[model samples]
Target: MPADDSPTGLSQPLYLCVADELGQLIAQGQLAAGERLPSVRELSQRRGLSPTTALAALRALEQRGWVEARPQSGYYVRPKLRRLAEPATSRPPSAARPVTVGSIAARLLAASNEPGIIGFGAAIPEADWYPVATLQRLASQAARRHRLLIGEYSPFFGLPALRHQIARRYAELGIAVDDDEVVITNGCMEAINLALRTVAAPGAVIAVESPTYYGLLQLIEAQGMQALEIPTHARDGLSVEALATALTGPQGAQIRACVVTPAFCNPIGALMPEAAREALVALCRQHRIALIEDDVYGELDFAGQRPLPARYWDRSGNVLLCGSFSKSLAPGARIGWLLAGRHRDAVRMRKFTTSAGTALVYQHALSAYLETQAYPRHLVRLRRLCATNVARYIEAIERYFPAGTRVTRPSGGFVVWVELPRGTDTLALYERALFRRINFAPGPLFSASGRYRNCLRLNAGRQWTPDVDGALQALGRLVEAG
Candidate 1:
């Protein structure tokens, strides 16, 4: 295969041109596993090609499993590859719930069907823009090793090497955890669920942000627990003062656990300061509350440094730290892990009973890939690309949205929260955008209390282009119409 620098003067197809450029980078070890490639526009600008040509190159790479696409976030390098293998058991089918058309979820799902709709609703990363060739090499090596460990199930916790990697990774953030403390799971959602199950019983009261991650609310509701809403701020997240007061006040007495996204929280993209994190940990310690810290977005920082989870302040083993590769790596891999301080035994028992364990092949592959140091190297590049994309999205929002529209500037993470004018219902705007084939997450889905009716969360992980800009403009029109 001739590189783009060939002097033969034979013109390569545009897609081939883009792919050759990527291939050279991978061959030179510049694009490592888990790294994101330049956005389509960025690549197009560099290669002197159009956006469609660049996308075609990326899509071709995607088909080969060289990269994986996150829902709203841009593409990311796949961790490692295993042969096409079916899950031992299909995901237990969710029973059909009565479909209520006008309900918030139904409306949101309905809006998803419209073409050319800008999605500000879902909190997924763009998956199409990742570097795939690097992942292919990682996967090839992993698959080759999988044959040797075909019958082995990782130790009840997880692969020791991966555990050690997790510990070392956390240590860089000022969290000191031993390898034995971590238990791998399917995703942060599972990690959080297992932690909650370990500490709180059905009907227990779990305090959560008033406008918390809707998934957590569902989990609480699923466990037959009541979520006590504590007021949270868009800038600080999960107010420590409010939480301290809530605990000592009447509501605190009944709370069994407190689940929070302390760093780069979802929906609002707020990063709790170190002092507040310490204070919250102290309060949880005093109140004897099991603090489940969701730090899925912690690794995607755009600011000075990544923030440590509240777990860093815990000396009493009260904090259960949940993290996942789904956000930072490949989401479809369904891999996540938790460091359940004092609650390790309960989490382990739940893991064994819930699904036995995560896919053995994937665990082995991911472990092998991590050993290559590809993940961290990939992350540095990915973060830089994400930061650039975020700035681009911010510029678009400023240009298109109404003058008084307030937007949250996230230090890291793929979500950007836009607070629209009061009384301008996002649900109504969602309907209007849907008619125009635009999809966005309405703000109400993030709230347990049905607040933030005028807010919307935009995915800033994709390559910003003329079409993306146009989509934002269309959304602005809908917002103004409302």
Candidate 2:
């Protein structure tokens, strides 16, 4: 076969083109489950391709759930696993309520890095998964080259080079953002906080997805604001129709801002369709409410396409976009960015008052890394690993969890929202799991109104180990005992 012989006639990577052909055979039942696939050399010879390309195709198939690799053996077609039922669309109360989050989330974060603990609590990935050594080397080189700048603070909007890199990334996603419009933030949280401060005030009503990220709830609580919960789907994301209805209700006019994670939202892992995203942007514009998008997980889509942020649909500069490398790259770097659109100045001032400026060394190092065009390559590996891990986690949950448990089938990101049998009281279950060195985020922490008592969220970002499986079994047994 010629190098350009993609069945789809598109200019995709050669490995993906080959993987698609193999995947089609699997889908058509030509490649039966449990059947061993051709060896790398055999495949290469058969396809008139190189061994490296053939191996890459097999790995791609493995990542896509079409095949599996065995130790010391070639790949085999993966058997279809039973799919778990997904959690239903959330139905939070229609009225706006005061944010009253508790210390559970903080406690979880505090214990996240503890040794001997199985971390299913935090969405953080293992450090080894990151290009840590490469970053360290880059940082050292930056320090040597710019030793005098070490004593100086980063610009309030961050290093111009880093801002340019961030803007270039957004441009790749078809979002036209000037580098000057981007603010370097400590992390996505600070970017969001700055957005909230710029748009809403104390006691203001903020529209949020029901069962949103716990950190967002904490942010609202810290600001003494009220949360107007909007029902969100398990898969499709925040209900645009529901949000529109709420916006026109008695509480609608008072809502100062709408915060959404249109791409793989935390816990529930919802990916809003493009139509919904466009509608959301338009609705916020009509209501004159700020659309603050937390797009930290936007680039982690397993489908190989980086999902566009809601900010992509902004026509009048009403969207405030927040993203971070914490999820995709080095979390310890504390690097994130914000595009505040028309609110850029206010956000910059807020960022200045909040943290003065982000660290410059990491920004310089990251900028250098981006210049090498390595970030995209890094994401390809990370996304593939995350997709495999997510599949493993969901399969384990289905096999080990209680009979009535339902989990989210996230197409992106590395977390899943699990709904246990009614009255399971996951908070109680969480405490029990904690005693066994197991940790998972209980459902109530994801909401301000103390909802989802029978729910929990598990982290698929962690490296899978025998200990993890044991912990899952232990958790299942504990639930059964209760």
Per-candidate TM-score against the hidden true structure:
0.76, 0.87
lDDT of each: 0.71, 0.86
lDDT of 2 by residue, 252-295 (tens): 88899999999999979999999999999999999899999999
How big is the positional error of residue 60 in model 2, measured in Å on the Cα after superposition? 18
Candidate 1: where are CA atoms >4 Å away? 1-118, 128-131, 148-154
- Candidate 2, 425: how far from true, in Å? 1.0
Question: Which regions of candidate 2 deviate over 4 angstroms?
Answer: 1-81
The TM-score of candidate 2 is 0.87
Task: Give a tens-digit lDDT track for model 1, residues 251-362.
Answer: 5667898899987888767788889999999989988999999999888886537787888889999999999987776676777999999888888899898867776555
In model 1, what is the error at residue 85, expressed in angstroms? 50
Error of 1 at 60 (Å): 27
C-alpha RMSD values across all candidates: 12.8, 6.4
Clash number for every model? 20, 0
